[model samples]
Target: MTLDLQQRANRRMRRAVITLGVLVLVLVAALVVIALRGGDAPPKGAPAPQPSTTAPKPTATLPPDDGGYVAPAETVKLPDGATKSGDLPVKFPRTPDGAAAMAVASARNAWSLDPQRIRAGILAYASAQYRDQMAASADAGAKGNREFAGIPATGPVPAGATLNAWPIGVKYAAVDSDTVDVLVLLRVTHAAKTGTQPTTTLIVSPGRAVWEGGDWKGTATDPNQPLPDPVDIGTVGFNEDRWQAIQEGDRL
Candidate 1:
């Protein structure tokens, strides 16, 4: 390839990667907003609840020797004939594993190349309490299937280019019988030209799933805390035990 052509390819690759990063940031911002604005404000003139004076019981903690890693204990079980709401999958089980599965699926669809698809995915997966808030912002400036979040949309893969993503790892915590928190790490690969090597980007996204109306639905993920930074797959700090490998059927 000519020098000019190579430079263009490099620019395209950079733009694609940046677009993915921006999409993640936008999603996070939306989640934070919903968390802050969700639920009813305290009734006018209502008294605040009193705090308990008794000391709380100690909860279990990971052993220091374990390097703060917690092995995945839940098993994902998808029901037969799992259905789809629009283009996004729906109807996961009610267990912690099911919540984790739904969370991963939500992240995958939220990053879709089509803005319409993204909007539909948000509507389908978001918890009822926050779904409208999330959907209203899903494609604020998107138009004509060419732009979303100010980046060029992935309409069709060119002859010499490719783009794909898959869930590689996950960490989950069951908050209660009706809620679960999940952190998912996705591996996104893109190439601007057939001969050029593909660039790999890692994205770690957190999601909360609430059991509502007999199924799991996505919600803001711990807005009081900051989101985790993305990390490379094989970095020294990466803990295999903490991030359980997502099975093929569960991946997107």
Candidate 2:
């Protein structure tokens, strides 16, 4: 009877050892799977990984770090032509394409803020027909301003201030073998001393030129309409001297 009881106890001990060994094998297999998957098994009640909620910031269009003193657009020029009025070309291109380039450049300059440059730019580049019309318009405008201000006809009268314009883009299309239609996008800035703030205006205006009598002469930029849509370039202070330099073709 004693031997039988001892044997029964030994059998029970063996059964318990086998159960523990099987449990340990199952735990080792689970750990191996987690290791192969490149991450530890998460604890119970732990939250799952979540997707990111961040977004990239917008790119800055204007410079000086904080949107002031923005860089101007690149200036386009004729390889064999004078950039400004009365600038003698050392060697002229004599090609129709070259003439078109010069015509476009001159037409854009006609929108200068300075009165003298504006007049000169128009006269130098415009066709005789448009030139006369512009002259008449200028006369009418000056006369109307004088009458409104009650200034004498012969006395000096100040005209309205012109906006500073920088040509940002130019698109040219050949209308004919001798004529080219040019469209210029200008960044026009108006500086206000007593107003809320200064602003930049983006204008895409029309220009047409014909290769006439060995040179290109500009026609009315807008033969069909008066003006194009003006886009606001946001509120910012403009450096006038820099714009003047660009107009003078010194720095673009």
Candidate 3:
């Protein structure tokens, strides 16, 4: 009877161990199926968006320049052979009488000029804005300056040194840009010796210009001369020769 009881206890223990092993095997199989299903499924179309790589920016532009004063149409070779541009130059009318009268009028309008000072230098200097032209006229006075600031002397004009008269020699010439030329015979005066009155001589050159305000004017500078000053928009037509042309006493 004791031997039978021991055999029955051993059988019961073996059955419990087998049940535990089967439960553990079922749990492991279920976990493996779940993992295989997840791995085998097709991937979704939408993915997390990534950051973008940016490109470089473009360059900036500069502003346009408005010429207040009449300037050269483009760059020009200077007397020194160097080139420069962007400046306001005086414009001259292309007529003999206009050229002759310009200097006289400028002299007459020279503010507070010593009425008796004769305006020798003023008359010559104010003819046009060209340093070259003015220097050319130095011989019209008492000075021996062959040149002023490196400009050679150009002598003998169409008119006299003193343009104190009217209906002087006049001629017209044409240039680019509807520009007309005026060649005027100026009458310049020199101090007389031996109690003689101022002597006179003729000066003729083309007065450069456009037909504005009932007259043609000259470019303050020679054609293509480099400008030391910048073009001013506020004074587009306000040039030295233009100013001299329309002065109070200059209504020709």
Candidate 4:
């Protein structure tokens, strides 16, 4: 009957959302590995370096230890009458914090099940030089989304279902006055219906952004640049890694 069909549709939508979230997490993991490894394979005959017993020293760019986590000193500022591109915010200040904010927003949008938001996010957040590449990636993502949902890329979710991703914590390293590398801890969630328990996944994604055209814009991650270690919130490593919790007002 109609009620049975509705339940089946909701279940299908939930499965699609969960599958899409897993795909995003896998993609993020691959990107992080590439960044960490500098995306280079060793020369065919080059001998591998022997492992060192000494512990690796922390990178010099990290904030000075204050016997505890050092909160980011810079604050994000929005432009006058700033608006959003789809559900993603646009027009952040020309500062390090602004770059971090933009990177975080980009990650949230890129991981969402809504393909329209993914496209809009790339257009609004990526740097001019990277837009075409990001657009191609978005297209691929949209195609995958459509395949999983059995609907058009811009189609709405089944009634009573919810799928979304958001940043929960952030860490950043300043590459210079004009560029920054940001790490965002994301929470991806899906619910089949109101009052139902939601399925959640966590991801730590790395991103880079530059100050350009009077606002912060996302750029490809620097293969050679060292990034901070990712840490989950509410863990000891979180404090040791100096991850800062995203404030309520900062959520995109």
Candidate 1 — what's its lDDT?
0.47
Top-lDDT candidate index: 4
Off by over 4 Å in 3: 1-167, 176-178, 192-194, 211-216, 220-252
lDDT of candidate 1 over 168-243, digit per residue (tens): 6677789999888777777655555567566554555655678887778765443333434444334433453456
Residues forming the 10-long window of minimal summed lDDT in candidate 3: 50-59
> Relative to the true structure, how large is the alpha-carbon lDDT of every model?
0.47, 0.36, 0.25, 0.48
If ranked by TM-score, best first, what sequence of candidates would result?
Answer: 4, 1, 2, 3
What total of clashing residue pairs does each candidate reach?
0, 0, 48, 0
Worst 10 residues of 4 by lDDT: 46-55
How close is each model in CA RMSD to the real structure? Answer: 14.7, 33.6, 46.3, 14.5
Local accuracy of candidate 4 as per-residue lDDT tens digits, 1-252: 133443343333223221111112223422222222232452111111110111111111222344654344323332331667655677777666777777666666665455456667667766676565555565555434332222233446556656566676777779899887676766655564556566554545555667778777765553333334434455556667666777655552
lDDT of 4 at 192: 48
Between candidates 2 and 4, which one is better according to lDDT?
A: 4
Report how far off residue 216 is in candidate 3 (Å). Answer: 4.3
Give every collision pair in model 4: none
Consecutive 10-residue window with the lowest summed lDDT within model 2: 48-57
Ranked by TM-score, the better of candidates 3 and 4 is: 4
Model 2 steric clash pairs: none
Q: Flag clash pairs in model 1.
A: none
